[model samples]
Target: MPPYPYLATDYDGAAAHAAIFMVQWKREGDSLARYLVRIGEMTESLKIIQQALEGVPGGPYEYFEMRRFEGLKDPEWNGFEYRFISKKPSPTFELSKEELYMRVEAPKGELVIFL
Candidate 1:
C-alpha cells in the first residue's frame, strides 16, 4: 500500500508537491540537474499514466507491453527517451520494482519509465 491517498482528488496535489520538491532541489546544480531533468520526464510520464487511467483513447501500453520492452534499449538517446506506448483505457497499479531501458547509441536516453 502507498502512503498517499489514492483518490483522484489527491493526484494533482501530490504531483504539485513533488514538482515543488524537485524544483526546490533543482538549484543544487550537478547530479541534481540530471535528477531534476529525469523528474520532469517522470512528471510527464505520470500525466500520461493518469490520462491512460481516465479513459484516454490511447495510452502507453498500446505501444509496448512494458515487460517486453523492459530490457530493450534505444540506440540513439543521449539521456532518457520517454517512449509513449498506446493502449485502451484501464486501471493503474502501484509499482514496486521495474527494470528500465536506455539507448545505447550516441546521445543515449532513457528508453523506458516503469512505474
Candidate 2:
C-alpha cells in the first residue's frame, strides 16, 4: 500500500498503478525519467477520469434542502432579509499539544509536514 491514506481512496487503482510504474522507472536527478513519469501519470489520470464518467450515478443536476431553514425566520432590514445568518453557534475544535509529523508522496517527490 502507498504511504498516504488518501491514495488508497482511488477506487479504480489507476493512480496507485501509475505510482508503482513511477517508482520502478524513476532515477535520481534525471530529467528524462521525470518526463516519462509525468506522461505515464497523465495517461493513468485519463483512464481514471473515463472510468469515473462511465460509473457516475444519475440524479438531479442540483438539489437544495429547504428543510434546513424550515421554521426559521430571517430578520428583515430595509426590505432585505438576511438568509445567511447562522441558526446556531459553530462548533470549536482543539488540538493536542503534542508535536505531529506526516509525509506523503507528491508529484515531484515526498512532502513532509511537521506541527
lDDT against the true structure, each candidate: 0.43, 0.48
Q: Which sections of candidate 1 miss by over 4 Å?
A: 1-29, 56-115
> TM-score of model 1 relative to the true fold?
0.23
- How far is 42's C-alpha from truth in model 2 (Å)? 1.8
lDDT of 2 by residue, 44-103 (tens): 667656655665666666333345335445533212223342222212324468965555
Clashes of 2: 0
Predicted structure with the largest TM-score when compared to the true one: 2
In model 2, which regions exceed 4 Å deviation? 1-29, 65-115
Candidate 1 overall Cα lDDT vs. reference?
0.43
Candidate 1 local Cα displacement, residue 70, angstroms = 34
In model 1, what lDDT does residue 76 have? 29
List of clashing residue pairs for candidate 2: none
